[model samples]
Target: MVQAVPDPRRWKALALLCGAFFMVILDSAIVVVALPSIEIDLGFAPSDLQWVLSAYALTFGGLLLLGGRSADLLGRRRMFMVGLALFTAASLLCALAWSPAALIAARAFQGVGAAVLTPTALSIVTTTFEEGPERNKALGIWGALGGVGGTAGWLIGGPLTDISWEWIFLINLPIGVTALALAPRLLRESRAQGQRRGFDPLGALSATAALVLMVYAVVEAPQAGWTGAQTVGLLAASLAMFVLFTVIESRVAQPLLPLRILRSWTLVGANVTMLVFSTIAFGMPFILTLYAQQVLGYSAVEFGLSSIVFPLAVTVAAIVGQGLVLKAGFRLVATAGLTLLGIGCLYLTQVSAGGSYFGDIFLGLLVSGLGVGLTFVTCSIAALAGVDEREAGLASGLSNTTFQIGAAVGVAIVSTVAVSRTDDVVAGGGEPIVALVEGHQAGFLAATILAGIGILSALLLLRRPPVPSPDQPPLVPVAEHADD
Candidate 1:
C-alpha cells in the first residue's frame, strides 16, 4: 500500500516539482532555438544538427517507463533528487562541450535525467493533492509551466546564444541546485510496498531499443528518403522489437509498464489524445521558427519574441480551461480545445509569402496556442483520473511517452510533406520563394487535417467525467466508470 502524503507541505512540494519540470521543459526548447548559434560555432553539418534534437528526444522517450518504474521502486522523492543532480551535472557538461559529438552525448545524458524527473514530478502531484478543484488547479499550473517554459525558452535562448550558446545549458544549474536542496525537506517519500521483486531487464532493454530505432527511422526518413533501405529496415526492426516487448511484458513478473492500465478507457483515450496533440503542438513551432528566420528575415531575438505570442495565449487559456473543467468536465473541455486546434491549423493553411505577420501569423498562433493549452490540461486530468495511487507513476509515464512519440512522428510527417511539396513546386518551374511558401502552407494544411482526425477521436472516444472518490482526497480525479 502507498502511504497517504500529508497535506501541510503539499503546496511546497508542488512548487519544487514544478521547478524541476520547468528546467526539463526549458531545455527542450532552449536547445532548439540556440541550434543555429551552436552550428555556426561548432561547424555542425545539417545531418549532425538533427542529432542535437533527436539525441535528447529519443533517449528521453525510450527511458521514460524505466524512469517511472524506478520512482515507484526507489521512492519518488529520492529518484527526483537523483534525476535533478544528474541533469544539472549533464547541463554543465553540455555547456563545456567542445565538439558536436560531445554535445550530443551530453544532451542524451540530460535526457536520461529528464526522463527520470518528469513522470515522478507528475506522480508527486497526483499523490500530494486531492482530486477536484485543487488537483485541477495544480495540473493546470503544471501544464502552464510546460507552455510557458517552451515559449520562454525561445526568448531566453535567443539572447543567451548571442552572448554564448553555452548559457542555454549553464542556466539550468542554479535552478536544479535549488530544487535538489528543497526536495528533501518539502517533499514526502513514497514507494510501492512490494519488496524482493525482480525487474524485467529484458523487457526494458527491448522496449527502449525499439522506441529509439523507431524514432531514428522517422527522424531520418525525410532526409534519407522514405524508400531508402536504411529507413525501411530500421522501421521493420522497430516493429519487430515492439512486438517482442509486448509478448515479454505479458509474461514478465515485473514489467516496466503494466499492461493492465491499457484496459482503462480514460487512460487509453488520454494517451491517444496526447500522442496526436503533442505531434502537432511540438512540430509546428520548429517549422515556424525556420519560416520566421530563414524566410521572413527576422533576427534571432525578433523571431523569439514573435514565437512568444502562441505560448502566452496557451498559458492564459490553460488557466481558463482548468476553471471550466471544474464546472463542465474533461470531455467537454477537451472536445472544445480539439475543435479550436483544428480550426487554427486550417487557418494556418492560408499563410503565404505575401502574408503579414500580425494579421495572418499571429492570429493563427494565438488560436492554436489557446487550443493546445486547453487540450493539454484536460488530457492530463483525464489520464490520471481515478488512477490508484500505486499506479500513478506508470500513468504519468504512459501519457508523457505518448506525447513524446507523437512529437517525433509529427516532426517527421510535417518535414516530409514540406520537402516533397517544395521539390514538386520547384520541378514545375516555380520560383524558389514560391515553392518554399507553398510547401509550408501545404504542410500546415496537412497538419489541420490531422488535427481534425484528433478532434473526431476525442469526441467519439471520451465520455463524461468520473465522480470523485470519498475515501481518497480529491487529488486523483479519474472517472468512476474507468475500465479497471
Candidate 2:
C-alpha cells in the first residue's frame, strides 16, 4: 500500500478531498440544469447537446482503471496535484468556450482530469483513516457524497446559470484551487513500494477507445436511425474494440483491468448493482429538469429550490443507512433501498404539466434520493468489503468506472427515448407542452423499470457483502503500475 503520513488533522484533509470530489461529481450533474441555457447560448443541436455530458463521462469512466493504478505507483498526492492542475485548467477552458465543439472538447479534457483525480480519492481516505470504524465513518461520509454532492449540481447550477451559463463551469475554479493548495500541505505522498514504472499503453488506449466509440454510437443512434449505415458501422467498430480490449488485457503481463478481479463475486455483485443504480440516479435528473423548466413553467431558481428535497432526503438517509448496514447487513439494506428507489421512480409517472411540485416532484425525488443515499453508502462499503489493501485502489476505480459509464448510458438512452417519443407525439398533433410532459413520464417510468432490475439483482445475487478487514489491506503490485 502507498504509505500514509499520520496527521492529527486528517479530517481537514478529508474536507479538501471531499471538496475536490464534490466538484468531480458536481460536474456530472450540474450540466443537467444548464442544458437549455447552454443549448441556446452555444446553439447546440438537440442531438448533439448530450455530448457535453457524455464526453466527460466517457473519458472519466474509460481511463479510470489506469488512473487508479497510476496513483498506486506514481504517488497519490503527486497524481492528485497533476490532476487538479488539469481539472482546474479544463474548467477555465470550459467557461471560456465559444462554440459547442469547443465546450465539448474542454469537457472531455475535464473528464481526463476527473479520471485521474476521483478514483484515487478513496485511496487517500482509506489510508488516512485506517481500517474499521474510523475509516468506516469516513467512508460512510464519503459514500453519502453521492446524494448531496452529485445531485447538488442541480441546485447550485440553477443560480449560477441565472447569472450566466459559464458560471456552471467557472464555479469549479475556486474549489479546485482550494483543494490544490491544501492537498500538498495536508495530504501525505504515498505509492506502492518498489513499483515498476512502466504503463500498459495498449490497455489504456483500447479501453478508452472502446468506451468512447460505444457511447458515441449510443448517443447518436436515435438521430442517425438505429439501423442507418453509419450507426451500424460505429456499432461494429465499437464491438471490435471491446474484443480487442479483452484480448489485450488477457495477454498483457500487467493489464489495465486484471480480468481476475471479475472472479470476485463480491466485487462483481457490487459493481452490477452500482451500474444499475447510477443509470437511473443520473438519468432521472436530466429527464425531470427538462420537464420542470419547459413544461411545468418553473424558473431556474424555482426549479433549484423545488428540487432541494432530493439532496436533503439523501443526507438524512445516508447517515441512517450506515447505521442500518452495521445492524442488518448489506443484503437487506441494499434490497430495501433499491425497492424504495423503484417505488419513487414509479411515483414520478403520476406527474403532470399541471401538477404541484410539493405534491408530485418533491415526493418522488425525496423517496428516490433517500433510497439512492442508502444504496450508495452500502454499495461503497460492499464494493471494497473483501478487497485486500493491494487491490483497494483498483476495486474503488472499478466501482466508480461503472457509475460514470452507467450514467452516460442512462442519459443517452433516456434522452433518445424522450426525444423520439416527443417527436412522435408532436407528429400526432398533440400540444407541445403535453407532449413534453408525457415524454418525461416515459423516462421516469423507464427509471422504475431499471430500478426494478436492480432490486431483483440485489435480492437474488447480493447475498455476500464485503466483510471488513480488521487491518488495512495491501496496495497494488508495482509491476502492474510502473510509474508513467
Candidate maximizing TM-score = 2
lDDT of 2 by residue, 1-484 (tens): 3343456778888888877888888888889998988999999998788888888998898888888888776777888888888999999999999999999999999999998898788777765676556666877888777568887888998899899999999999998888888887887666655457657889888878878877788777767889998788888998898899899989987788889988888678888988888888888888888888888877777788778888888888888887787678777888888988889989998889888887778878889988989989888877776565555667878888988888888888788888887888998999988888888888888888889888887876676444545564533222223333
* Residue-wise C-alpha lDDT for candidate 1, range 60-126, written one tens digit per residue: 8777888888877778888888888989999999999999999999999998898889988998888
lDDT of 1: 0.79
How displaced is residue 29 in candidate 2, in Å? Answer: 1.2
- RMSD (CA, Å), candidate 2 to true, equals 3.0
Model 2 regions more than 4 Å off: 1-7, 227-233, 466-484
Q: Candidate 1 at residue 348, lDDT?
A: 75
What C-alpha lDDT, on a 0 to 100 scale, does residue 474 get in candidate 2? 37
lDDT of 2 at 49: 85
- Candidates' TM-scores? 0.92, 0.93
